[model samples]
Target: MTKPIRKAILPVAGLGTRFLPATKAVPKEMLTIVDRPIIQYVVDEARAAGIEHIVFVTGRNKQVIEDHFDVAYELEDTLKARNKTAALDLLEKHRPIPGSTSFTRQQAPLGLGHAIWCARDIIGDEPFAILLPDVIIKSQVSCLKQMVDLYNGTGGNVLAVEEVPDDQTQNYGIVELAEKINENAAHISNMVEKPAPGTAPSNLMITGRYILQPQIFDLLSKQDTGAGGEIQLTDSMLKLMETQPFSSIKFEGRSFDCGSKAGFLSANIAFGLDDPKLASEILPFMREMLDQPEAAE
Candidate 1:
């Protein structure tokens, strides 16, 4: 029987040290790409993928994230009183149904694996999805939805992967293909996290989306520190591989790593250009800046 992936874990406990100063006071997940926060995009993707429950693995000073998804009674009342139908509608559209969202604290700066473990009870006895909040994928269909479709067919662990240049394989968790399932999906025989240069089995790097079974919780519980002395999710996943089959799908989308300044700016521009209301204004401004680098100055 194929288990439905109804819950998703979003590990958002990391301090955004790379984007300090701005991130010093604000949680990076709350940083906005356009009008919506980065985390909103991630949540939207999960919702589109049929996830019924969302588990946010948060840390200190990340209360804003919980608040963002929660109802703002005062704001909504004020909008209603002022007859601001559009604003109220927008809020209603994005607000998760009551009891659909859950938040738990990681309590420390442990790695991604530990953050996820914090939500194990909430995700009890079910296959679930894990979406890294910092990575945003802009696709016609949500990236997680694509993975869910593949998971529904294959009935095992499924990861969203993308082909990277051979030279860049060491920067990612690369997978070794065992059998060619199709043009888009494959049976992964092995996974090497950040393999040394010239030694990567394949260039298909793991993107931030995953559909995993509940047994992974057991593996994560006993996982040791790896790479950075923090419980690494990759380490646990590799161990889980010994018992289960793993598959990958080259999803149709462009992913932006909003964790970095450059990727953040790129996401802003990409999303800005896609917004019908902003595209006409932003595209012209971007072209002007590019065509005449010093004219505006």
Candidate 2:
């Protein structure tokens, strides 16, 4: 039987240069979406997918993330004393079971491929999922769970993908499809990271979610720096495709690119609208913003 994918790697080593001052001291993954940090949403998704091990690839000044996952004993005790059952219950849900989570440091910003490689010791020989915390995906079904379901049947690498406009294909890793496995799935012929406009293989662009076979570690180990003088994950993935079956599953979800200020704000709004308590208050605020002449312009 194929080994079950029980582990996942989250790469959070990037210096959030886009958000500059705010990120100078804070990790971007700790930025709040509504009230929860971005990494919390990623962890929640992994938990929903039955991921038993979460290996975080971190870097300097990211201690807050580690603390966020740990039990806040002082805070919990105070809440308990105050008889705040609901708040205490919420905090408990954020705590991972002891020994189920681990962290490793990525001393340099070598890129996504290198970040994944940092978790090699923890991952050992099993297939694992990789989720980027910068991409907040909201879906009825967890994106990782959806990919895991596909991986079980296909028994190979699977990437979460979504169609982008032809002009925007250059901004993402584009996939070349060989055959249609189904309406929402296809055998990927090849993948190219950020192909120039009009030169892309297909409109389908890769999302942050991935289910990769452990064999990828070998390819990544010897990977030379590609694009931007960094070890790009897409390059190693392309090499792996040459020796194994690879496919892309079009995920059914709404993805928010939280790496940028605009995407971050938009995600906050989108999630706020989905909340029952906040929807009524948020709709009017959004409408007022829309009614402003500057907004129309």
Candidate 3:
């Protein structure tokens, strides 16, 4: 029988050099999006997909992320004493169940492959999902939930993919699909990480959210660094595809790459526009910014 996917690995060890000063002491995953940290959105997606345990592959200065998932006794008590039921309830709603999360250190910035490998012990002998906290997928049905539904039926290896512009294809891992199962699904025969500009096989790119069989842990066990002197997950996946049934499910949503300055700003704006507390205040502020003569130039 195909083992059910119950655990998810979140790699949060990357040094956010792009956000430098802001991430100087804080882990990038703790950066807020409409008041909730980026990792919170990723965890919410995992929970929605019925994930029971979340394994975080962390590094230095990532203690805040662990604390974010833990209960704050004093804060909860203060909110309860002040009759802030709504605030207290909101906090409780997002908290992960006690002992539902496990943390392990990646030890080095080897690569995404190594980061995921760090969680190997926690994910022994079962299919697991890997989620990148930097990529926030906005959808009616959470992206991971959507992928989990596909994983149940297909079960070998599945990736969450989306269409990208031809020119933008060089920045992501591109795939060469064999056949189309449906509009949003395809059989991926092969994949290439960041192909040269204009040499991409298809516009589809593997963004984030992967459901991989446990055997992949073996492939990653001795993976050599590729593409950038770092062990890349795509390289390991390419080797796995030689034998496994690999497919990509295009997500029905927008993805915000919150790892860069521009993408981070865009996510803040996008989520800010969706939040009730910030909507009214930001709407006029945005309109005024757009109306400024400098914007037209």
Candidate 4:
């Protein structure tokens, strides 16, 4: 039987160079899509998927991320005293259980594999999920929840994949399918990180969601620097595939690559359109922008 996945690791150690000036002081994870920060959205998805423990692999200038999860006693008290019930309830919803969350410093920006390995002690011996905060997934069924459901049945590594154009496959970790396991899932024969265009094994590219086994820690421990002299997670995952069965679930969700400025802007617009209070105002503003002659020029 597949061991139930109870923990989730979030690697937020990267310097958001793409976001530039805005990320200079504030961690990119704190950047809000509409109202909530990016990391909060990821946490909410994890909670929806039944994740009981959250381990954040952090780096320098990342203390704000830790404090975001911590209780704000003075703020809560102020709300309570002012009789602001609704506002107080919203803040309390994001507070994590004391012992259920943990933070570990990654110290250096080695790579995704190293960041994930940093959580080894906390993860111990069970399967766990990894959700990249940069990839904000908007779905009816949360992306992590979809993977958790697949993990319950597959019992091995499960990665979230989406079909990308052939030419764009080179920009992502491409997965080769050995066989079709289901209508929307398949057995991943292998995965190659950022394969050269036209040389990609398949069009199914891995997104940021993953349900991984504990054995991956062993592989990552011995992993050498691969592409860009970084301990690439895809390299370790490829090694793990040799000894374990791996599967890929084609996630039925819209994923925004918030790591880039364009994607971030797009996410704000998409999320804004979904917000009931903002939609009516935002739509007309967007239409006005479209109708403006200067914007066209």
lDDT of 4 by residue, 1-297 (tens): 889989999999999988889999999999999999999999999999999999999999999999899988999899999999999989888999889999999988899999999999999999999999999888999888888887787789999999899989878988899888788888999888888878999898889999999999998999588888889898888888889999999988889999998889999999889988899988998999999999888
**Model 4 TM-score on a 0 to 1 scale:** 0.97
Model 1 off-target regions past 4 Å? Answer: 293-297
Give candidate 4 regions above 4 Å deviation.
294-297
Model 2, residue 40: distance off in Å is 0.5
> Candidate 2 or 4, higher TM-score?
2
lDDT of each: 0.93, 0.92, 0.90, 0.91
What is the model-wide C-alpha lDDT for candidate 3?
Answer: 0.90
In candidate 2, the residue pairs with backbone N, CA or C atoms under 3 Å apart (3 or more residues apart, or in different chains) clash, namely none
RMSD of each: 1.8, 0.9, 1.2, 1.2
Could you tell me how far off, in angstroms, the CA of residue 105 lies in candidate 4 after the best superposition?
Answer: 0.5
lDDT of candidate 3 over 1-297, digit per residue (tens): 578889999999999999989999998899898789999999999999999999999999899999888889999999989999999989989998888999999898999998998898899999999999999988899899888888787778999999999999998989899888777888899898888998999999898889998888898899688877988888888888888999889988889999987888899898888878789898998899999999999
Query: Candidate 2's residue-wise lDDT over 159-262, tens digit each?
Result: 99998999899899988999988888989998888998789999988989999999999989995899999998988998898898998899889899999899
lDDT-sorted candidate list, best first: 1, 2, 4, 3
> How many backbone clashes can be found in candidate 2?
0
lDDT of 1 by residue, 1-297 (tens): 898999999999889999988999899999999999999999999999999999999889999999999899999999999999999999999999999999999998878888888899999998999999999999999999999999988998999999999999999999999887889999999889999999999889999998888888898888588988999888999888999999999999999999999999999999998889899888888788878958667
